[model samples]
Target: MSTNKAIFTMKLEPELRDSFMAAAAAADRPASQVVRELMRDYIERQRQADEYREYLSHKVQRARAQRDAGDFATNADVEAQAAARRETLLKQAKEAGV
Candidate 1:
């Protein structure tokens, strides 16, 4: 851990703050350490969520371009393909006694 530090202050219900501090003490760790871990975890999760959103946005853009170029399958066409695949799988499953 880095020694560089700054104070962060926030207001919460006194009872909640007291309980959190007591829990930290019971676990033999400082409240600051627990708070820092929580903050870091939250930040990483937010970053991952943002990256996923960006990926989905790009996928949507690509799909839209494909649609515009008349290069994508229609919903009915996709459903028909899926139905054929399902039938083949069901037959295989029956043969395998699965």
Candidate 2:
């Protein structure tokens, strides 16, 4: 055990606390260790979520910049391009007897 640890407290339902303790006991591990692992995992997931949000915000900004500069395609243009590609593929598939 580390001497630098601090005690933290919070409130939760009695059933949840009992279930968690039971699970830890079943696994032959300390409940405190299980709580520490859960807290660390939760923090890591939150950090990843924050990073993804930052990336998505940057992507949206870039897209807006492109749209503002008139350097982007319209939805109709994209749909027409997709339809043309699909038609080409279908023709090629027929030619190949596929």
Which candidate has the top score in TM-score? 2
Tell me each candidate's RMSD, in Å, in order. Answer: 3.5, 2.7
lDDT of 1 at 70: 97
Q: For model 1, how does the per-residue alpha-carbon lDDT over 1-98 read when each residue is reduced to its tens digit?
A: 78889999999999999999999999999999999899999999999999999999999999999999999998999999999999999999999999
Q: Kindly list the per-residue Cα lDDT of model 2 for residues 1-98, writing each as its tens digit.
A: 77798899989899999998999999999999989999999999999999999999999999999999999988999999999999999999999999
Give residue 41's lDDT in candidate 2 (0 to 100). 100
TM-score for each model: 0.77, 0.78
lDDT of 1 at 26: 100
**Could you tell me which residue pairs clash in candidate 2?**
none
Q: Candidate 2 lDDT (Cα, whole model)?
A: 0.96
Q: Candidate 1 overall Cα lDDT vs. reference?
A: 0.98
After superposition, the stretches of candidate 1 with alpha carbons farther than 4 Å from their true spots are 82-98
Instruction: Report the alpha-carbon TM-score of model 2 versus the true structure.
Output: 0.78
Q: Model 2 off-target regions past 4 Å?
A: 1-3, 83-98
lDDT of each: 0.98, 0.96
